[model samples]
Target: MKETDLAVGNTTVGLSRTLVWLMAIISGLVVANNYYNQPLLALIADELHVSESAAGKISVLTQIGYALGLLLIVPLGDKLLRKRLILIDLVLVIAALLWMTFARELWMLYVASLLIGATSVIPQLFVPIAAQLSNDQEKSTNIGLVMAGLLLGILLSRFFGGIVGDWWGWRSMFGIAAGIMVFVWFIIYKMLPEIHPNFKGSYKQLMLSVIELARTQPVLQLASFRGAMAFGSMSAVFTTLVFHMEQPPFQVGASVVGSFGLAGAVGALAAAKVGKLQTAIGTYRTILYSLLVLIGSWGFTYFAGETYWGLIIGIILLDLGVQGSHIINQTDYFTLKTDAVNRLNTVYMVSYFIGGSMGTWLASIAWQYAQWEGVCAVGATFGLLGLVAHLLLSRKIRLAAIKT
Candidate 1:
C-alpha cells in the first residue's frame, strides 16, 4: 500500500490541517485526566482522610490503568470505527470524572481514577488516526502539531488543577474536568470523521499481533525501552515534587508546585519545531541529544532543594528532552508498518506508562527513605540508562549496516 492509502473502515480519508488541530485539542483535553490528580494528591488526601502515601497510589493506579488501556483498547482502533471508539471512550472519561467528583470514600476515588485513566486513551487513538491521515512528507509535522496540544494539556493540567483545587476544592476540579470532557465529546462527535478498519481479525488475533510485534521488532523494543526510561525519570520528579516543595526551605503549596509545570509546557511547545528537525538531523541523533538534556535536567533537580530556579530549569529540559525523543520514536516506528500504526502505538505506549507507574511507585518509596536527594538520584539513574541504551543500540545498527 502507498503512504497515502490510509484504510479507515472501508474507505480512505485525507486529514485537513483544521481537522488535525481539532484532534490535537481533543487529545490535549482528554489526556489531561491522568495528570490532574498528580498535583491535587495532597489536597485529596487531606479531604478524603488518607495519608500522603496512600494518596500517591491514586496517580500510580491511574497510570497503570492507562497502560492496561493501551494494551487492550488502542488496538481496537485498527478493528473498529475510529470516531465511534473515540466517542465511546470520551463518554466513559466524563463518567469517570463525575464519579471522582462525587466519591465519598477512598476506594471510590481509586476505582474512579482507574476508570478515568483507562478511558482517557482517546488521545492514543487520535495519534494513530492523525498518522494514518497524513502523507509521508507531512507525517512528522502533523504528529508534532497534535503532540504539542497533548503536551500542553499535560503541563497545564497541574496548573489548572492546582488553582482550581486551591480556590474551590479538589472535587470542583473534577467537576470542571468532566464539563470540559463533555464539550470535547460533542466536538468530536460532530467533527471527527470515521475511518475504515484495517484489521479484520478477531480480537484475540489482534492482541496476539501486539505480543508478536513486541517479540520480533528490534526498533520497537529499543524505542519502547528508551521511552520507558525517559518517562520513568520524568514521572519520578513530578510525583515526588509536592513532598519536596512542602518542606523547610520551600514551604510551598500544591499550586506553587503546579505553576512549575508552565516551564515544562514551554519545552513541549518547542517539540513541534523539533519534530521538523528530525528529517534534517536524523532520529537517533535527536534522541541522543534529547537524552543528554534529560540527564542535565535531573542534575539541576538534584540541587533544587536550595532554589526554585533549579526546579524550573529542570522541568523545561525534562519536558523538551522527553517530548523530542518521543516524537522521534513514534515517527520512526510508524514507518515500519503503515497497516499497524495503532498496534505499534499500543506496544510503545503500554511500555511507556508502565515505566511511568513504576517511577511513581519508586519515587514514593524514595521520598519515604531518602527524600529529595533520593528522588533526584532515581530520576538521573533512569535518564543515564536511557542514554546508554541509545548509544549501544546506535553502535549495533552502525555495525550491522557496515556488515551488510
Candidate 2:
C-alpha cells in the first residue's frame, strides 16, 4: 500500500497530495479575507475621514468576530457536514465583502469587517480535516503544509491589499476580494468531500462537551495559553507596523509597509519544517525555544525606528517564532482527543485570536503613549509571558509525574 494512500475507515480514500495541496490553497484564500484590511487601515482612514486609531479598531473587531466564530460556529464542524458549513461560510463572507465594498461610514465598514471575519473561518475547518486524514506519523507535516498556506494568505494579504489599495482604493480592494471568493466558492464545492460528522448531539450538548473537554484537559489549557501569547506578540507587531512606517526616517507608503510582510513570509515558509523539529525534540520543548525566539525579535524591532532592516529582521524572527510554536501547539493538542479535534481547535484558536485582538487593541494604546518602543515592549512582554508559561507547565507535569 502506498503510505499516502492508506484506507480511511471502510474506504480506500486517503491523503492524496493533490487533495491536501488543494485544500491548502483554498484555505489560504479563505483566510486571506480577514487580513486584507490590515495594511489598508491608513488608506481607509484617510478616505473615510477618520482617525488612524479609529481605523485600527476594525482589525481588533475582525479578530474578536473571528474568536466569536471559533467559539460559536466551528464546533458545528463536529456536529454538521463540514463541507456544507464551509460553503455556507463562503457565501456569508462574499456577502460581507460586498457590504464592505459599498460602505460609506466607519460603522458600516466595521460591521462588514466583523461579518467578514466571522465567515472567513472556513479555512480553519481544513486543519482538523487534514489531521483526521493522516496517521500519527504524518500529522504534523500535513498540518504544517496547510498552516504554511494559511500563513502565506495572511502575509500576502498585506502585500497584495496594500498594492490594490494604493492603485485603486480600499473599497476597490474589498470589491476585488469579493469577486475572487466567487471563484473560490466554486472550487471548494468541487474539491471538498462530504465527510460525516463525528458528533451526534444537540447544539447545546455539543457546546457543553467543548467546555467539558476544556475543563478536563490540562494539555489543552497549556497549549492554548502558549499559542495565545505567541500569536499576541506577532499581532501587536503587524498591527502597529503600518503606523510606524509612516513616521520619521522611513516615511514610506502602504506598499512599502506591506512589503515588509515578505520578511515574515520568509519566516513562515522556513518554519514549515517545525513539525520535524517537534518530531526530533519534544513538542513542548520546540514551543519553548520558539517563545525565546519571539522574545528576541523585539530587540530588532526596538531598533526598527532607526532602520528599515531592523523591522524586516524583526518580522522574520517574530513570524518564525509565532508560526512555529503555533504549528507545534496545533498538532500536539489534537493528540489529546482525536474524536473532538474540531472542539479542541475551537478552544485553541479562540484563545489565539483573542490574544490577537488584545495585541491590536493594546498596541494602539501603546502607539499613542510610547510609539514604536511601546509596541516593541508589548510584543516582547507577551513572548516573555509565554516562556514563563512553558516553565510553569513543565513544573506541573514534573510534579504530576512525581505523584504518580
Q: Which stretches of candidate 1 lie over 4 Å from their true place?
A: 1-5, 8-11, 395-404
lDDT of 1 by residue, 66-142 (tens): 99999999999888778888888888889999999999999999999999999999889888877877888889999
Cα lDDT listed for each candidate = 0.87, 0.86
Give candidate 1's total backbone clashes: 6
| TM-score of model 1 vs. true structure | 0.96
Per-residue CA lDDT of model 2 for 24-134, tens digit only, reads 888788888899999999998998889999999999989998998999999998887778888888889999999999989999989998998888887678898888788
For residue 84, model 1's alpha carbon misses the true position, in angstroms, by: 0.9
Per-prediction TM-score to the true structure, in the order listed? 0.96, 0.95
